[model samples]
Target: MSVVARTVGLVTANLLAPAPGGRLDLEGATRAGAGVPLQIGFDEIGVPLSEVTFVVVDLETTGGSPTQCEITEIGAVKVRGGEVLGEFQTLVDPGGPVPPMITVLTGITDAMLVGAPRIGEVLPAFLEFAGFGPTTVLVAHNARFDVGFLRAAASRLEMPWPSPAVVDTVALARRTVTRDEAPNNKLGTLAALFGATTSPDHRALHDARATVDVLHGLLGRLAPLGATHLEDLATLGDPVPHKRRRKATLADSLPTGPGVYQFLGPGGEVLYVGKAVNLRRRVRSYFTAAEKRKRIGEMVDLTQEVRPIPCATELEAAVRELRLIAELDPPYNRRSRKPHRRPWIRLTDEPFPRLSIVRSVPAGRSAEAIGPFSSRAAAQSALEALEEAFTVRRCSQRLPVVPSAEARACALAEMGRCGAPCTGAQSLEDYAEVAASVRAGLTSAAGPVVAALRARIGTLAGQQRYEEAAAERDRLRAYLVAARRTQRLRPLWRSPQLVAARRTEDGGWEVVLVRYGRLAGTSTVPRGVNPMPTIDALVATGEEVPAPSTVLGASGTEEAELIADWIEHPATRLVQHEEGDEPLAWPVDGAAKYPLPPTA
Candidate 1:
């Protein structure tokens, strides 16, 4: 045998050969120091790397398949901040004969494991030594193999598996060390490249020790890529090298709070806008090897600097992001850049009021609009449905409030589809009553107008007029959605100011302070803390927003839309104030006439 092979074989035998206490002393010979392990699945964005714990592990099995093969040996080194805290090593009888080829490769024969414990006996002890906590991460040369075996064993034994975050050193090396530095990404090859304290010779403990070294080496490389937290390492997959990473320093100044961020190109031209709960972590993520989008990489390359604007809440950040995207018209933004361009169905303020589709709500107009529809077709469909229920005027004439006698009723009047108010056939009082019914239907889906439309649709469907029924259904859906949107916003429009709170995932409360229809401020009522004080503070800090009438016309600003969305959230509950400060009234029985179909 070669000198190197002989030396490695002697070392492996010495370590594997049980001690007087029937435990391996390999850890005592190699472990640097005892480390303090952190909790499992630890996820904090700015947590220092020194506080993170990694359980580097390796396993030797009979074959590749976990079910078909059996694990012969398991080894792991518990590490925290570069210190070796503990070790787990064991040999297991496969409950079957060892393959000759495997024995030759790993030098672990059936005779060596004859009196050893089975996997069922060894796994529990290994898991206990390795621990399962939030801050703990499992590392392996090729993690999939080791993790798969453990998972299979857990399933077979029906043991509750604590699935800690796993990191694959092979993947880490492929991104950290170039092929020129370490030709093939095998465990031994990387071990030698990183100058691991122990050489891997197929024995589990030695291989695991070597893997720990490689992990530390790769972590050093990850520092320049902005991976400084425990959670960062879990997502640090193979990244296509980004040229913009050189400008990664630009994101260093971003705050670790909820906010909107802008990527600016040369001459300070905005290239892209994005929102994140943690500005620093999100902007830093682009510099890491994990960002895979080619477009994002290209944008990052063009980006010369990053600008972060902190907000009071994630919802505020989302609204600010939309506003910034619209204001800058950044080339990278693909949506919500034109919140004002949505269609609205307006009721013209003439003697014979008629529905008119408009992109913007005309200022100083006496017309009331119900919209912000996705398209004109949807608005027109809703108008047609309203006409079916209320036969008002459809003409485009500047008639007197007392109906002009010179007006001519079009084909609609002859077909009994219109009240013929244009020719004075329909009196002003009667027409006003029809207009009131249309307004009620437009504001609430449960109103009489929608009920009439629903009944009409059902009658058509029963008669096998399938196309007519479908058309009516489409009209009803459009009207319902517009009404729902208006219903959510109308409360803010009616109330000068509204304070509300929604339960958060962390059992806290998210308080939103709004003026008119805009979000003025927001704050968090942390768990076990008094929410009233926080809510009061948030209200005191609210910015003065334009009155709802002037600010949110037909289609409101993005911020208004955002606040409306918040008010409609099912978990949101309004805090009781004086009776005089009551917010906009909603349908007490609920808008139940036309139930929305399941989304496609």
Candidate 2:
């Protein structure tokens, strides 16, 4: 039919219509990727019904929340160039308990999907079979629900959708039909009106077929003239496709001590090396976010790999981080030019409180200070450990004093923490000497208690006390990790400052959280705005922390405010780290895996 003729026929029929117009009936919404609203058969925009290719998809979901919900049944049909492609029908394994309502709607029980490979298996096979590829287009009654599933699936698998273009047939039906024609334009009524003799089975494939027929009839009566290409067709309702992604699994990175970590990629490339107080947990989150995921997945798919070198302390981790970067030359390490130093505790006032890595001497000396650890997180952890084990005071030296009669020294002095410069227990000169000794302890052997424990370990081993020796070893490891945690405090954001924490697919990054910028408490993001890691090599270890400093480069001042609001929300929780969790073992150099022959 010519375009002019179709228009004339539509208008003429409108004028001579007995009632108002054909009642446009619509079925369920799209259950896959980025689904749109349920568009009526006759779209609000008046797409004229005749100009576009259409497909109908019916899905029976195990439940809602596409991630948890699996489709029990999927029925789809394509109509383009006025012909239906092969009917798409399949029963998917939900891999979990199926809901009663879903079974009732679909008539597909758990027994049917039980032995089925699971939605993961079914989705890939079905899409491949359904001609979802570069050139394929799709249409559904309601696009949103259907599209959401597709998105979730794709992300879970770490692959981009094969096809993005799709149309909602329900929209066209609504635009062409009048509401007065029927109380509602559900599938059954529309099928009867279109002269399609099929009975409504509520089965996926059956409904899809009925939709195709009705759409075919509409096309026959409405195909626009000279519509030579797919793009030429006017979109009735916007096409909604499924968007897929994996969930994040971070948390457990920030710590009180210092340590080192490696950012690995496919084929074992060292993406970067970093140091943190909490090493194990900080490494896992890189892979979980959306942005980092694509790269990690791609790298893993091409070359699967992972690698991590442990350290005893944050100071050690900082030093090790620089060494690894120098040796590994990971392509992703851009800010490696700066040298790392364990922060030095410097006194601030005349009595000088400990200063660490005094990045710069504050002009004349407003404060005492120490180092510039490879990262601030590491430095803080180290300081904390020292304070705990050495019994050094961590509070600022400039404490408030009571009246002379009341200034009998705080309880800290009584508890041996005050160093007693107040009540003539020690002279200022003598206190300085003691403080100097405390600072010197950083390089000295641990105090008498540690020495005594070491001697015990040696004595137990000499007496063949293997069990005692082993216990001592475990204790030492714990102490090392604890010490590391206390000394380092700057490499990571304060917990809950990171966003979506998850491991990457390729196992390159254990977890990757993003912070759009400083104002956004890092943890509030839950899922940061960075690219997520890939699927194949998954090793999600830690939660993602935002790059608070990155706030500088963003466009507007409001960006900071926007981020601040998100962080302050009562729902935000700090990311926590667990000990001994490790990144997966992987190769440094790219290597190929080959199928093995039969064993000899």
TM-score of each: 0.80, 0.31
Residue-wise lDDT of candidate 2 within 475-571, one digit each (tens)?
4433333222212221222223344233233332222232322222111112343333321111243333332332121212223323333334454
- lDDT, candidate 2, at 434: 56
Question: C-alpha displacement of 409 in model 2, angstroms?
Answer: 88
For 484-550, candidate 1 gives per-residue lDDT tens digits of 6655565565456678899888899988877656667788878888899888777777786654333
Q: Pick the candidate with the highest TM-score.
A: 1
Q: What is the lDDT of residue 44 in candidate 1?
A: 39
TM-score of 1: 0.80
Worst 10 residues of 1 by lDDT: 14-23
Angstrom error of the Cα, residue 434, model 2: value is: 80
